[model samples]
Target: MKKPPIWFWQIALLVMIFIIWHIATSPDLIPPIFFDNEYRAAFFFGEPAKIFNAIWVWFMSGEIYPHLWVTLQETLLAFAIGTLLGLAVGLWLGLTPLASAILDPYIKAMNAMPRVILAPIFMVWFGLGIWSKVALGVTLVFFIVFFNVYQGVKEVSPVVLNNARMLGANASQLLRYVYLPSATSWVFSSLHTSVGMAFVGAVVGEYLGSAKGVGYLIHQAEGAFDINTVFAGILVLTVFALLLDFVVTFAENKLLKWRPQQAETETT
Candidate 1:
């Protein structure tokens, strides 16, 4: 017999998970070993069918668009601003030994700090509007790209730098040709992670305080004990996050075609 395609297994796994989730959550579908009441299972875990239904209702009623748009705006703005700041600071510090040494301890301390606590401070400074959420997301995204770019610059071979210097390459020429290209790969490598962090920051900010966004929706659902709607909101965020990650991969492929391709494992 022929082997099934990889995608077949992927789809099958998702279907199986949904089936199990449905069974485990539907009242009377299974014994209430964990919960005192069979209804409590469905109440706490929520039924898969109802979760999907809640999503469908939100779309059909056209209620989720504005919220989604708000989240997308926050995420994109945060990603852009953070990436720019990271690129600039990383390039500067990575190139300047004195500056890097001066700020090394402070940079490490800031990166070590938990960013969630800063959300409240941002809310106070920027208010409950979109800027607060964007500010929170920038903090989340900045470090990842900063580290990657800094490392990339440091990774530039001394031999290559010497050759360029001997060839009379000026500072601007060396930066434009040597440093930027070396850092490009690292920047792209960090894109997926940084984008996800931006999404996380936006959602978290919205969860804490906001009148809009999917996180806001989930918060509202939680207050009302509407487990299905909460799950639906979560699902929406997850799906969009995945789509954004896919875009990053697609852009990487297009932009990095000049780079060597990795070998794929053959199924024998």
Candidate 2:
């Protein structure tokens, strides 16, 4: 038996989505159901065309790039800082049992709390500028990578560690040759997820308080009752999120080439 190429399935899925969206949103395809003088069920269910039109307008007008760049900047900065901190902390804690024991309760308490609610506090401390958004994003991204790397290092084979130690491997050699290699997959796995979380944190921070970023644009559109534009802004954020995820995936593939490749999983 033979299977279709993976890209063929991807393209087919995209085409099917386009077809359904076009059919559902075409003005001539369905009649509007009036809910009230001001509300129409069709408007709610059939806004795909409107959303696409708004996106077209944005692209043609070239007004979206600046906002997109602002959001990207915040997301990237936060991702870098958060991932670095997570890697460092995860390694340190994984290597030092005493330090891990001392910080366990405090770390758990902080991670357990609703971090987003701290946005206002962050804004008060860091202002409504990009720093606040980056701070929020860093908070979101940090714990994800931290937990994964911590677990990854912990999961290193005891037999392997014993053999290395018996062979006279020092602390630095064990970390370099054993812990990092063991944790590489876990780090990349968390990184892919952290990318999205970082973006979400940044955008939500912008929503709460910001003069710029795509989230602010979306917030403005909603206040003006421009549903189409709001949807367009959402679409822009989703596209960029996918782009960032793709970047992480590429890095993971490059870094974890020693890992066994798995069959592609079905995506909903």
Assess every candidate by TM-score: 0.95, 0.86
Tens digits of per-residue lDDT for model 2 on 123-241? 99999999999999999999998999899989999999999999999999999988987876787877878988889999999999899999999999888877778878988888888
Location of the lowest summed lDDT over 10 successive residues in candidate 2: 33-42
TM-score of structure candidate 2 = 0.86
Error of 2 at 123 (Å): 0.8
lDDT of 1 by residue, 1-268 (tens): 9999999999999999999999888887778878888899888888999999999999999999999999999999999999999998999999999999999999999999998899999999999989999999999899998999999999998999999999999999999999988888899999999999999999999999999999999999999999999989988998999999999999999998888778756778
Candidate 2 yields a Cα-based lDDT of 0.87
Model 1 misplacement above 4 A: 264-268
Clashes of 1: 0
Q: Give the C-alpha miss distance for residue 261 in model 2, angstroms.
A: 2.1
Clashing pairs in 1: none
**lDDT winner among the candidates?**
1
RMSD to true structure for each model, in Å: 2.0, 4.1
